[model samples]
Target: MSQFSFLQSEFAPVYEHALKAESAALSDPRAACFYARLALETAVKWMYERDRALKSPYDTALSALIHEPSFRNVVGNALVTKARIIKDHGNRAVHDTRPVAQQAAVTALRELFHFSYWLVRTYAKGAKPEAGLQFSADALPKTAQVEATTLARLQALAKSFEEKTKAHEQAEAARLQTEQARAQLEAEIKLLQDEIAAVKKANQAAPDTHNYNEEQTRDAFIDLLLHEAGWPLDQARDREYPVRGMPNNAGEGFVDYVLWGDDGKPLALVEAKRTKRDARVGQQQAKLYADCLEKEFGRRPVIFYSNGYEHWIWDDAGYPPRGVQGFLKKDELMLLHQRRTGRKSLSATDVDSTIVERFYQTRAIRRIGEAFENDNQRKALLVMATGSGKTRTVIALIDQLMRANWVKRALFLADRVALVNQAAGAFKTHLPHVAPVNLITDRQAEGRVYVSTYPTMVGLIDDVQNGVRRFGPGHFDLIVIDEAHRSVYRKYRAIFEYFDSFLVGLTATPKDEVDRDTYSLFDLERGVPTDSYELDEAVTDGFLVPPKAVSVPLKFQREGIKYDDLSDDEKEAWDALEWSDDGQIPDRVDASAVNKWLFNADTVDKVL
Candidate 1:
């Protein structure tokens, strides 16, 4: 019932302070004040390190603590005698009628180790002994009864702490196991990257020079990704995951599957392409999706374009190599041929003007859609490539939710203005039947799919939680954070934890090697789903176009351009870039060193 209990966990600082007090009373004043400080420091040192809680009796060094005046008064003579027994030996050796030899100090140090052991056996892990110098429970006299009660209470506390220790150990073990699994996954991914590099090394394949329509290729590539790296298909080929549209204009648009995890929210408009043909064309189609989609709920929709053969992933945020990608080295790699295929490159006109679609379902899309529609409390992050009809797939989801009446209201968020503007336009164009649509922003808050920027949400959370002047609770029933990769921060996390919004996030690139903060958010928010079929289904079904990788025998075509929008740390990286003997990157470049580098038009302007 105490205020402090509600405010914070009490165990951390209490034990530390008590141990400090105990040490100060035990150190001998005979040595310099330095020795006293040393004793106190040593006693408390175990606090910084792990002290095994042994069940056996600690007979020696513990003597100092138990025999001290304060300890004797608190405990009893029996405990004091145990401590004194060992102290007596050291005393004899040091105080004997002979010069104190090197052996005396060595012997004292040995006794100190025993004291350290006792420290671990006792206070270190809260290990309780059967009996110790304690207040006797016997109601024989005033002092005895008081002593007994004190010991009884201490015994109970010790017992409670032991249980807590066991729980702590189990939690730690689970965490370590999770970490190990992650490490193993990273290693496997690295191996796969090496394999891809080896394959690309065989021949330098040039970029596709094609004059083609969008649909066939997008479907082809999606199939490729699914076939190569997605999961198996169900016997029914999975029934339709219905897309429902809410009447509230705020809740417009139909959607397919939405995958939720601790990672944030992702909405997927999934569709599996049959992996029957070459996957090259599919990739191009998926890439085009980026041009059409808009931002939603301050995040971007990730396009997972995979057929049963190859996977071509894209994100509304313009990030590539999304799901499972590895850097393939080119020296031994087959360089992408610089051949000029008579085929012409794609023009903007060739790309689909409509990024967000209403309804399109393949077995893969249906399965994912079903998952989302059926999922009760999970928040999802949907990934697909640019040209792939992620919008269309998500539309089905919206329609399904409305039809089910599961959603009272929904919020659509996105990563950027141009991107979300596409999402907003989609609602206006397709779901016009739904009335009273609202758009949420720093300045405006209306709409079922509340679209805004990640920074805006983070800022709003700060306003709500800290003593900021603005903010009301329960902003939305379902919060969809678009461009989730860019929106993770302390404030964003605070809002999610502080409110009860059914959140769903979407992105093309689910994982990024850079900006670990995004992954950290994923771990904290979504405890990695047990059923994940990204790599397999895409490969088996021909949705995403498989790569015809041509690793150029070059380091890189200049580490592309660093985007103007960057976090604080990224800006620091930008400010420090150095070139090698030719155009390759160097290891380090400080501010002063960067200024020294001469720039010429012939040289690449940006650093990796």
Candidate 2:
């Protein structure tokens, strides 16, 4: 009688988890949310295994799996959004200790039901399930016993399954009977793939009748986002809150959501619109709500508006509304409120001398500060040549910004792992109080400054846990790009666009040598960067030593070496070496091939 009963046949594996999720809805809400996500993940992994069209991603993390291009193409936008909601809520249920509501569990089950319906309709090999089948809450188990399991245990179980799969494959390779079993499994997978393709082709010819319930999905997603940011939403007054002094004839309107401070005054107000509508449509409406709250409490609250997919935060008295990936945490919002009156001038702040005592480095930091505070520029590029203390200069700049209360958190991105480690060490040594975290080694470590390679940061950019992203748009107050060049701009420009943070690009290459696109990324002219210190200047000022070139003359390098000219021991050694796979050796070696194809210890030592 379970709404997920249809999964018992072909999707038996998923059925067990889905049934548990459905049964636990009224009893253990957290387990219900977690199991629902597990069921969806199982089904999706099943599809990837059997369906030829769905290619696997390099990283098999659930977030990466669902967001993979091929997977998205197969599921479409509606199912993708559903998967996101289930995954997000499930993440929250496991990661957060706060009690999850029964309604959240119910919403997860409903979304899972629709997702299961799609899977069976598209992939079921035997006679397809009835199109008329509908999910009913009444069909869910009224009372049922559930197991107590932790997220760690579930993850270990998943890992065990993977190990077993590998072991089974190895056994199949060794024994003929097991090999035959694997062959049969492969054949079944092929048949299922064909069936999936046929079903999709047939579905294309028919009228679409599936109901996505986008409006409800949108509201659920927004709620999960708020929940992730530490909003309990337990009280009846949290949503559709009543307020006075609207511009309407009634002189009042219900605010969509109001986040309250401990004193009962409003911390912030959110105005939510339908998913399809522009989030900006609620901007003026949110302003009105803020005005009403300020009148009532004698304190102006920060305003936010969203359509589930897009979110914006505006401290109207100080700054314009800007799009954000998610809502800020309570402490972050409180800090924002405090900063309205307490923030000091960034341009007036003195650069830390202990971090960077060089004259050019300090000047570069001052120029960047002016670009940010005076010019109101969001991005700045520093073109300092190699060995010119680019890393230390930025470290000093971050110290200044942090002291002036302009930045709370910062991210330093490097293109190479070695560079990430190197920069992290510099930051730790100079700004020890900030506590830098190297994401390359330990991603879960928490700190004020985060350091990562470009690829590592790209993988982490979309990571959401308990309905909140690990690296939201507003997560970092500043993002520093190391070795900013053409490759970074071409391959990882999305990282810059995704985080709504002040940016600083550091490069050893001069402006003229650097790519035009890299300059454009920092909103600078092709030959004019925010600041520059050429290698020639550094050398002239005695900050860096000029390179010295020396030429060494070697007999073998200048002329070719003939086999007959070698001494007895040298000839024996040459004959012993393998010149090619066929064991053939040339009669003579060319001058260009002295170091390229031939190596002599005595000659190399002499040259050195």
Best by lDDT: 2
Error of 2 at 65 (Å): 2.1
User: Candidate 1: where is the Cα deviation over 4 Å?
Assistant: 1-376, 434-442, 459-471, 486-491, 510-540, 547-608
> In model 2, where do residues sit more than 4 Å from their true spots?
5-16, 27-31, 46-58, 69-77, 93-101, 120-134, 146-202, 205-207, 415-417, 437-447, 452-475, 485-500, 509-529, 534-608
Of candidate 1, the 10-residue stretch with the lowest lDDT total is: 331-340
As for model 1, its CA RMSD to the true structure in angstroms is: 29.3
lDDT (Cα atoms) of all candidates against the true structure = 0.36, 0.83
Worst 10 residues of 2 by lDDT: 146-155
lDDT score of residue 309 within candidate 2: 69
Give the TM-scores of the predictions, in the order they appear.
0.29, 0.76
Q: Model 2's lDDT to the true fold?
A: 0.83
**What C-alpha lDDT, on a 0 to 100 scale, does residue 608 get in candidate 1?**
14
Candidate 2, residue 156: Cα displacement in angstroms equals 4.9
Scored against the true structure, residue 604 in model 2 reaches a CA lDDT of 71
